[model samples]
Target: MTAVPTISSPAHLSSPDGKTAMTHTPLRIGLIGAGGISHSHLRHLLTLGADVYVYSEAGAAELVALYGGTVVDSLDELLAAVDFVDVATPTFTHHALVKRALEAGKHVISEKPLARTDAEVDELAGLADELGLMLFPAHVVRFFPEYVLLKEAVASGRLGDLAVLRFSRSGAFPTRTPWFADRALSGGIIMDQMIHDIDIARWVAGPVERVSAVSSHAGDATTPVEAAHVLLTHSSGAISHIAGIWGPSHLPFTTEYSVTGTEGSLAHSSVAERNYISHLASTDAPSGLLPEVDPAENPYFAELREFTDAFGGGAAPRVSAAEGAEAVRLANAALLSLETGQPVDIESPSAQATGK
Candidate 1:
């Protein structure tokens, strides 16, 4: 794990009343895409007091009208005008945009599944390092309050050694764009949606050793609703069962998980009356309702806030590029397993060096 640098309190940003000073010049940020998700980012950026510029192949005018940002005609113009670029474009465009931004000496905050392949991600990471720029992937699940609390529980050993993890994420199929249904562009449901649970599982349970998966849309190109079930065997002997569904357009988004450890269990369900529940063998451990999240707080806002904080402090992002790459790697492995109908072994570095 990369060590996170301490966040320095910049003198110019401090105030006499001990509150954060808002007088500092706002960071200029260029948003690369203006889609459904871009609106959320735009709102958050405005709340963060960022000077926003937008560039999009389509809907630039509408976005500018709605969000009140300068519209740039080209990527170069946007890159030259901002200190950072937020790439919210389609999955296929990530590599080129990120590479260009890094080459332009602008820091990047890209939406997840950083790139289509591991090699592309590695290349981007290398270029970011060479250029001394930050490449932060927006794995927004890490910023979700419930997931953060679950991570804390596991890290504090309140649940003891984790043995089993079951996670599910289901939502209406994305029909706004045709590319999302294309496997070449969106990487299907595994890479597009299941990658969230993939990252969370790896984060809490450690490295994955093997992956076995089966999907409904594996061989069917005409299928609109995609669904999959995957089993991951972690290096630490913990197993995770993950399920993903892209139901019909009218269905609502829902996610749930249950983590079982030697001492107790923690579970959550979006559809349940009580969203979070916990049972611990030790009397000292907290049970029942977890800390309530501020209803006004948006996870995307929290993610961008952390990114800006890290950018100012010259610290590592909450989610590193390497970690994002690993999530993509796991997603690919799951897809491979789905195709082959066999368990795929994840080759560790030592094993690869020895040609095991």
Candidate 2:
């Protein structure tokens, strides 16, 4: 059986007096970037009954037409009008856009990686702190019910002392956008794709002391890399093997995780025909990040709702801006390990790394 803890939001809302209120007030949400990921967020925001405002260089009008939202003419207009901004733009643009939104006194929910570099993340974090605003990285996997259950189980000691864990995430290599291949922009596979598992690893296995990685990528930052594997040595002595791949266009997206402890184990696979509840078991499944989610149970929806409540002066969300910085730091550490061919020590570091 799973330990089902209720971490969902309360009925709290933002009051005109600038305090938490139980009465729901209309929240004006500004969505920047009309990419595919933005579509997911827009749908969820609508489901949450938010008044949506969208802005983008391209596709904003089209997206608003297909979905429901009023397209804004400029980023400044969107910033000025909304309570918060959801940044679903390309990897390289997150920091600047998030900073601009924060400076505008709007809270932020940024897509993953948060930013490309540690310095960028630090600047955003500091700005948010100075402004006394919240910046959440939409690490949606944390909102996935399966993952939430696993995390609760771990915390409950149902599986006893965690001994080892394995996580795998894969998806079709994002070729629609050239930025996905540019290591400087996307941080290659580690920061863009693998960072999902990296964040989860830290969440479940606790803080990491060090990291080592190997990649199939050869040549420079712009070179297209297909796959990479990372090893995380957690502070509590548990080890995790995380694999990320950008496979063929025909490759089905999949994700699976196995957590083992002294007393028992639990596992789940997206491609499974059927899954048991008791122990870790599977019968040959296709796996990676962004698994098939029922429309009603979309993790993206759950994630955004939580952030939306927090934006409404509710409780803080699960993934904080500092933790977002840490994810970038750890991903950079793995990238550094690839560069130097040695394990990178994070125990005594200032989030500096030699790679993207």
Candidate 3:
């Protein structure tokens, strides 16, 4: 693998006329992990004007060959050369990789479920803050067109105080990697698959005060199907019911949401988007945890572009490091409820930070 040079000197350069005109440099971004969700971000990074330097022990060369990026041989070398780090690795490695990147004085963008625990998420955020670096969690659902519209409707007060939010996401178990079934690694179905709606419930309604959940599972030892339902009581007195399923391989990836407020309601279903959305053309489509949408109009691109702009001194992106931590807290609480068969109370992040 060829090493790409890093550009890190005098923040500005002089134009031909000797005037201090600001010019943009294509960011040297180090993308870690070349697995499933990685390809989505890589394709968009190249289109969004980035000099991507990928570091993957398994599939770095193959991914770069297909995606048009410089392949790096090691994580240390890649970190030394890139301006920002994009973590697309497995859930188990997110904490360590993100902390390492932030400590190296580079901004970071990590995939959802920032870390396995609330304490880890808090530590990462505090580390980035003390180091004066940006840490963004790639919660790409917020950038989706329909979800954005739903958020807009709620924010505009047309929804007149959300009362109930219902969401369901179901897809086949990702047997390809064999990690998805391992709760210790993937955080089970709730943290892995349902966190999207978990984040949305807070993003639209408000912070949650309590959570209760129940689950059921059946099938063969490998690729067994499981489903769970979680009920969240929000601080604003709204109720959110979230359901998730990792079904048998025949199940098509599907998601649906219905949000109702005092005034009206909004709903959407992936089934309706069959004609509009574009499923992956690859053979591994059925085995993927996520449903492939149109790459040209991908939300992944929007979130990554926003993070890059923020790295260049722009406003913070829609999702923040702290919010990412909160999502993890919610999932953690839900998992506890699933195990104990009881409702769990959650403290607000601000309250926790203030030692309340």
Candidate 4:
């Protein structure tokens, strides 16, 4: 077992205004797997002033040349060189890479759907806890300004109690990689694409009690157009209808959501003239809302900033390993429900351990 290093607070200088200054040494980060998504990670990591090292099995040299990182030949070499590891690998590689990094006592920020199965997620979470390391899953949607505002509105009692939540995320099929089409590897549209809305539903509506789903990719595996309608029954008695669509290859990316509560409702539509809108029972008409942000800002940068801040301060990450695991569990349940045409019950980690 690798000896876990104690995380000391980063050095900071105090300004005359009593605000802390950015005097801390930049975090040395290792990025694994350079693919389409890795560019986003690299851009964000660079913006944060981190010393980045990259390793990819297929194109380490090319990625390093393009992204300006020291090329390492293997995962072990990269792990040995950095304090934190940002995993931008494919869905199938997440479990093993995370496990190795955690065991090596390195803090990790992995892309969403932390693992394919609930059990795998549990094991990794347990290991990280035992080792006193941080494992943050990159659920970037949570960091989106509109989503953040929506969550705040629901949590502030402004919306009273949530009743029904509807979400739709549609895009052209991601045929960039061959593994994306493989259900066994990527978990198809539900696990790969819809997990974002699934996590959002869990964040706003509380734990999901049961899930029932209908999918278009029932029998024919080669279908180019894949769609799933998932119904989630939350423990708080709130219900959610999540629709995921991978239209044709030429379709544009779009997302829309509506959260209805006893008091009011908040909604967003990519196709609408105004993207975000909210209605409160206390008010008469719907109000158009737009988050004040730089047009060039990327939510992925915000997500990485959160991880680095938490890691430096030795505090808990916003999205814990356990939460990431549950997201995967929920996605799996939805897929299972889709296949069996029956409602799938979601068991908590404790319930599973107790065999309840």
Candidate 4 per-residue C-alpha lDDT over 1-356 given as tens digits, one digit per residue, 9 for 90 to 100: 12223333377789899998866677889999888778878867776678889989887688778767788888889999999999899998899999999988899999987987777888888999999989999988888877888888987888889999999987756665779888888988899889999988888778888999888753234436789899999878899999998755445566789999999999987768632223212233321211233446567777887788787785555577777888888899988987788999886623321100
lDDT of each: 0.80, 0.81, 0.83, 0.79
Error of 2 at 61 (Å): 0.6
Per-residue lDDT over 103-128 for candidate 3, one digit per residue giving the tens place of the 0 to 100 score: 89999999988998878888998998
Kindly indicate the candidate among 2 and 3 with the higher TM-score. 3
lDDT of 2 by residue, 1-356 (tens): 12222222235767889998774456788999998888899987877878889999999999989889999999988988888789999999998899888888988999998999989998998899899988999888888888899888888889998889999887766776888887888898999888988988888768788899998853343333388989998877899899987765445677889999998999988768643232223323343224688666677777887788776657777888888888899999999999999999887433322111
* Cα error of candidate 4 at position 7, Å: 14
Clashing pairs in 2: 170-288, 254-287, 254-288, 255-287, 255-288
Prediction 1 TM-score vs. true: 0.85
Question: For residues 226-335, what per-residue lDDT tens digits would candidate 1 score against the true structure?
Answer: 79998999878999999998855444566789999998899987768632222112233322111223547667778888897776664565688778888888888898
Candidate 3: regions farther than 4 A off: 1-10, 14-21, 272-288, 349-356
- Pairs with steric clashes in candidate 4: none
Best of the two (1, 4) by lDDT: 1
- Where model 2 places Cα greater than 4 Å from the true spot, the runs are 1-24, 217-225, 274-290, 348-356
Candidate with the greatest TM-score versus the true structure: 3
Q: CA lDDT of 37 in candidate 1?
A: 79
